[model samples]
Target: MPAVSAVSAAPLPAPPRTLGTGLLLVVLVVAFEAMAVGTVLPRVASELQGLSLYGWASSAFLLSSLFGAVLGGVLSDRRGLAWGAGFSLAVFAAGLLVGGLAPTMLVFVLGRLIQGLGAGGLGALPFAVVTAHYPEAQRARMLAAVASAWLLPALVGPLVASLIADTWSWRAVFWGLVPLLALIAPLCLWPLRGPAPRVGEGSGGAGLLRPALGLALAAGALVEGLRSPGPLGAGLVGLGGAGVVLTARHLFPAGLLRFAGGLPTALAVRGLAAFALLGANSFLPLALHELRGLSLTAAGWVLSLGGATWTLGSWAQAQAERRWGPGSRPLRVRVGLGLMATGLLASALAVLGGLPLWAVYPSWVLACFGMGVGYNSNSLYALAAAPPGESGRLSGQLANIEVLMVAVAAGVGGALIARLPLERAFALAFAVTLLAAVLGWLAAGRLRRTS
Candidate 1:
């Protein structure tokens, strides 16, 4: 990882004495928060009797998450990680409390918005933390640990959420994280040896907010558009297109708008990869439970298992990153996507073949592993391409690409599932995954040198 030390931002601050048990624990708690939501969401919808707005609950979190993450990047780059992490954790806790106590559907949705903002910040802020404080070798290891932190949560989040929802209430799942997030503030201040603020992002970062919002609006509107009827749907589509144009002008370099030097193409591949996988995977739990007749607990376990395998895939990529540097990223990404396609096909075939729900768990795990591998591969290559100072902002933009793509994909995937048989819908998704993998592979071939 140090061979790529040139990629680290200039004159890096000393990292913590060590990543420490506390920091890892903080990461674990956060990852569990992420995984818990999926399990509890259905229960919330059923209890609240707002099935029509079910997708909004998730989409709202995702949208706000985009905002929070991008904002965190800018904030952390300007302020120190301490303040950034502090603000984000407080926001996250408040959202959870609001969600747990909400009495109305609208209130619940608002709470999700708040949580999404926090979640967005929490997700990418860790990357900023690593880049800012840790040495290259230790930073890479911490990143790997951060990846692994998701494993325990992935193993238990669903199961725990399922039990809470079934035996007690869904709201408990939200409230549960409050005490956990409470620790982040104090933990942040303890290792307080850095310069208070790392560096200011200047006008370029500040100017980006409007476009991020536009992108978010475009994404939300695009998903919402799919739900409308007749001319109203057309209106929504038109609005979404405008939002995309607005966001594009702000997000990409001028050359990218003109399709120069594969910038737009790079962004497109990132978007497509996320869309094909995240979009398809979003509805998979429902497919297993609703179509295959698995219990909530069983479905939850399957998802958790998949999450666990995702960590493994990410871990493997870290090793690959060390051994292969930028040269091998494309092959890894291609393989990751190929695995995704294979997993999707296996899942689709299991459904088509009427394999018992219990028998098909491994397929979803494979899909998860594929997603993890491809995702990290994308990150290493993309980050290696950018100027070190731009890493935080570029990461935020890439994150926006991922979340926006998933938003669109989920809506599209949802509609497809509604119209077609579960198996056939899955097959179509698998085909799309294959296409994205091909695109990623082709693009990867351009990266012979680290430059």
Candidate 2:
């Protein structure tokens, strides 16, 4: 009886750390693909004589992502992280293949839509995986590592994509990623192999699919409406705006728009931050080149600096958590939002006020720093608060809000630029983004409330 007791009490094996690191690396690959695709998209449009449909390529991706995000969460909750993750990668690889071999612009856009689907799902799965697999103590560090992965892509993605487009062909860029993904797929899948752990109760995956598609359409219409010209555009915008409100109700947790406390507020804050930051980021290079008269190379370098500084900020949050603790989450969020507002406002002044070009540099660093801390921390808090079996849902909501905000920002920015003078347009965009940061700051308080 004593011997049997000792055998039963023996230590269980330690969970593999490779899973955490591999997931981060998978995010790295996704970031790189997104960054690289953006770099060469212009050439692809020109070569395929699809300048008219240029915006559609990206819009399609954004639209499809809505479905992907929700589906990923549902799948993860029902089947497990492995199934969701594997499917996303497979779909992503297929998109890359189709896009790479596409001979027409329409086909290319179709490929992008597929890619968006996969990328969206892939994006959500990482958070779900982290929540399901990682210990609370290591989650922040893992998130920090994920954030850091973006640094390399942001620094080199554009240059590499451009060089390949110039020296060889854009197809190579897409095809090139295939082999790399083949390698990454195995690393990611290696840890996922084994008996699947049920993340929730019985599978009800199909139930979420319909609403997800509706949400995707809503976002797509909004993007298209904003980009279109004249009364038609206005009509689409009106219709799409209505659809967004209606569809979002089903897509998000109840009371999200009303700022209901708990997961809803956290998700809302994330949406606001993304809206502010991505809106500003989309315009930063344009402002630098057009207003400041900097060369493209110079503008790229400035962006790179911001990306590098973002990594620093991510590392700082991890270090703070390691040294101090999680009790400071609210303070971190507040400070992050404050910095974001300050940086964007200062940048708006620099751009609109005609300050020296160099002024924009420090402003971007500050803004990126804020994003690094705020975004990662927001994810950590929201996921941490999520009820068991609902991590995937939280992840989906967070990603959905972010994707929607970014699309809205881009659409709004484009509309402004079309209507007003470049400088005024950019100034207004920056001002709007600053307001988003302020909103985020206000919303952060709700996170402390019990969900």
Q: Write the per-residue lDDT of candidate 2 for residues 40-96, one digit (tens) a residue.
A: 998999999999889889889888988898888887777677777888888888899
C-alpha positional error of residue 110 in candidate 1 after TM-score superposition, expressed in Å: 0.6
Best by lDDT: 2
Candidate 1's error at 398, in angstroms? 3.1
List RMSD in Å for every model shown. Answer: 3.6, 5.3
RMSD of 1: 3.6
Identify the leading candidate in terms of TM-score: 2
lDDT of each: 0.69, 0.80
